[model samples]
Target chain A: MGNFMEWLDRRFPATQVWNDHMAKYWTPKNFNFWYYFGVLSIVILVLQIVTGIFLTMHYKPDVTLAFASVEYIMRDVPWGWLIRYLHAIGASAFFVVIYLHMFRGLIYGSSREPRELVWLIGCVIYVALMAESFMGYLLPWGNMSYWGAQVIISLFDVIPYVGPALSEWIRGDFVVSDATLNRFFAFHVIAVPLILCVLVFLHIVALHKVGSLNPDGIEIKENKDKGGIPLDGIAFHPYYTVKDTVGVVVFFIIYLGVVFYWPEGGGVLLEKDNFTPANSLQTPPDIVPLWYFTPFYSILRASTADFLVVLGSLTAIAAIATPFIKTKRSNKIAAFVGYGVIAICLFIFDAKWWGVVMMAMAIVVMFLLPWLDKSPVKSIRYRSLPFKIAVTIFVLAFISLGYLGMHPVSALSTIQAQTCTVLYFAFFALMPFYTTWGKTKPVPERLT
Target chain B: MSSNEESSNGDSTNENRSRRRFITGLTSAAWAVSAAYAAVPLVLSMTPSARARNAGAPVEFDFSKLQAGQMVKVEWRGMPVVVLRRTPAMMAGLDEVTELLADPDSADSVQPGYAQNPARADANKNEILVMLSVCTHLGCSPVEKLAVGPDPEMGEDSKGGFFCPCHGSKFDLAGRVYKNVPANKNMVIPPYQYLDENVILIGDDEARNA
Candidate 1:
């Protein structure tokens, strides 16, 4: 104990401030990928909140001034563009990291067994983040914001009873107006952040209670000897702290680089049209969200094939509820499904070309996953690098197809657009086959 | 004893070796290239940047530079939306549009004040007709079908107005939409009561109040 005290004095004098918590603290040994991201996510949350606070100091929320004020910040204020870009990119980046982090839980079977509540809280955080970004997107008050809301609100019009009324109720008036803008501004700056912060705290508390999972899918308790030492657990300080610090530093350079430099130049980091004020009269060509949202945006815009639209919407919602999917599942199957998810993710990241090329492929891939595996390990031979790469490229082709399905050009023509849209539908409808048949990839022996 | 004292430190030595190698890699040419590229724009934005100046600067259009029927382009808030004078044929086409438009009077619709007068623009009636090239329906920019006759492919604005090639939405010379076309409103008369002989500032309105 005295030696530990001496070490604390030497290493983390800051530990002295939290004597009660730090005194009992030992490094968690079996901590895994799932653990690292929670910490990273928390750090990023703090970053987003801090940068957001600075941005709000200059942002104007009134309808008449909102667009011009953003421009004022961009043109007049020093580094205002940087602050706005950080918040914008940070919002998108936040979702990317959180999605990856959530996928980590699905990969390691963190969603099941004793940690279900932890997984649930994390899901809650995901939902809250979506709402926060939605509201924040509106605060910019650009044509994209106004029209994107116009289109999305138009979706409620398709609802059976009281649809128009519901849409109007959602907007708080006839159109996306001052009341809506002011209210969205309030929620973006204050309400959502407050809720998001609280949810993050709860997510952490839940994670800490169950400890964290490791890569091997083994429990740390299994390695413990008669001695109290966590056989698998390692001290977080100096060890993982340094490791995570490396990631944080790299991320910091990225964050700072984006914030200090060309903010909204587009094709990356900042959106170009977003630099202009919200003009209702003049619409920017090709309305789309920040890239992180394109997958679902592509899905939502795929077709008027209402059933496929419903299915696509359902699949997107399922992505959030994925944690709940494993509660009753066998572990190996859960992990295999998880891998299927990862394959889909890789395609989403790289699939840039437009048309049926990508969509036709994802359908086949998803359909094969189930039939490929009656059990997890039986699927091992399917994971050979070449086949894996084929499945990846094929699925990537399908995402590209789905993306092109959104707004095909005149040279591309209506038939071309419809064909791509049909293929997107075909992909979702045939999910069971391509996924089940792809390869009998080996799965985990059991879920944790 | 600490692990350092008890062990031969093979793992520690290996870890240190790897960390050094990693740090060494960080100083590679790739990092320099990435940093250079990122810094170029950052440096440019802080200076006399093109995007900065082009975004809100007062755009000058030389009326004399344009031939009576020829169109000249100018930037409005960095958009390539057009502004040009109405030729006599386009001006004559406006009379036919009154009965067909939703708000034929241009009442409380396209613009305010200086635009309230018929033909909705300033003196030198044939000189300037300012309108963004954008279409109100789905936001596609309408291409000018700048001709005189009602040819087959000539849209409803066949007489001469902006025609949205995307959805076939059409607007007249005064930027008024033809009835039942995809565009319901006139092309937004961006807030401008012209500045003087040839210059217009887009960000601030200089139009005379009625």
Candidate 2:
């Protein structure tokens, strides 16, 4: 073993690489429950890819056979039901883990200056994961899958000039037929998964580069001891690896519990409508997207011609109020320009198009969070009360939107969703003001 | 160094640098052009194939078979096409909901010029509506509520139109979208022309003109 290690060290830097990433790598010792989700996300990703690979072995992409093929896997193939359940439920679990992981970042300021690229890469992974799950949802070729693809692909049609042609190109036919199914299968199985693996790899490398942030959001590296080891830091391998194992074991008990007992997740993980074969002539009475996508889906359904008028009036009010805020000259000017541009867009584009834009913007806005926040300190512990109140309202609005998107549309729900959509944007739009507005507690020299 | 010597040395270096820059620029342009050339077939391969295009040819429907206030559905280009023979009462209902429509004139909606009127039907047969059954919102076919009174799917004071169950968008007898629904425009009216007094061909108006 010594001889082999010596030979390998001359050629490959195997030990060095291990020391850099795992064995000797120092991480803060103050990690808590919120830290478990990062490792859980990796666990779910690996579970999805492995189970997904096994599923593609028995799954057929043809529209005629796809639905039956899924049923066959559930009924005929050996242990195939377990694999299918894992993959299906794992998709939703992945989102749950990811959303919590992201919330951890928001509260802890893991996306602050040095870690901005890590957060950006993480946001991209979230988007890619959504695409992967969306395409994977279609491989069953069930009624909900067919119509879901129809609605989502039609979103591309809201573009002005090449909208029709672009959507047709995406479908590879006039409708979501066998051609679309086959292409989506190729993407779900190979193309997107490949991109996801690369992105996850990049996300980890970026995270490691900046070092992990703890709940206190202090840089442990800044207060290193004589040997250059952070005083509060512990070796990641023996410390975090063991701690994360406990999290993984606990996560599996609950995950496998859902898989074995209630894999359908009460029609949110897997919709009841998807059990039937697709028919182009009919649509399900209430077509809700999966639970993970409900918030953005609600945003898409909230926009109307009157909604545009509401948005225009809001923009006008903000534009009128821009002069009263005590800020830099440039920020006030930027506020006016932003409101002016939105007001003009309300005239130039239809509300249907704005619905698509807003749905996409809901995700895109997260990419700007690191810059949008102008707080003097990191971590919610040291942040002001206004910021705390804003975050509370934002989380409440997001949860409400998610719940509302799962049901059929009604007058009350539409009004509720419209209000939530405004609050969702207001969280980011007002971040610069509220983050810098109130009194911040003095950060302690060490983790509490 | 003397000024002349420095100038001569700078001139030779400038000539060599310009030569290298030109070669690099030319190579980059060639690479970009070839990449674009390779992408053309790759991108075009994802469009509708020849077989799909061939299957999308114009379909003829005999509208005379439809009774009053009844509708017939046919497949055109993999989409449902509804040919409805509107009763006089249903035609009059379209006028009642005109004030509540986003585009009562069919002005931002799609149709051939001959079908762009309030009825959204060919001028020769104004009561016969030939529109794509696909909802303008997300392409799900709308459930027909052609009755003249209240409906459970529609409201108590409903004007009797098509209702999309997915997102609650509504359309009148002429296929014009309602004012405050998720769908912004009316259902599309496919380009069609009369073959006979009771038959209409859907999906290829220019071919007959040619």
Q: Which candidate number has the best lDDT? A: 2
* Residue A161 C-alpha lDDT in model 2: 96
> Please, what are the lDDT tens digits per residue for candidate 2 over residues A4-46?
9999999999999999999989999999999999999989988
Candidate 1 residues lying further than 4 Å off, grouped into runs, are A1-36, A106-109, A112-117, A265-269, A305-448, B1-210
Give model 1's clash tally: 40
What digit string (tens of lDDT, one per residue) describes model 1 on residues A1-448? 8888788788877556443223333444545445556667878788888988888889889888888888888788898877777777787668768766865654444554556677767776776787688778877787767755655554454444776676666666545566667877877788888998888778766766666655544446455547764665555555677778777776678766766664553444445556566654454555655555554444333332222334445556655655554345574367557556744644452111111223234333433332332222222233334334444443464456445533423323333434444454444444323443444444443322
Off by over 4 Å in 2: B1-22, B60-67, B122-127, B193-200, B204-210
lDDT of 1 at A278: 67
Tens-place lDDT digits, model 2, residues B27-75? 9999999999999999999999998877878999987779999997888
Interface C-alpha RMSD after superposing true interface residues, each candidate, one decimal:
13.2, 1.3
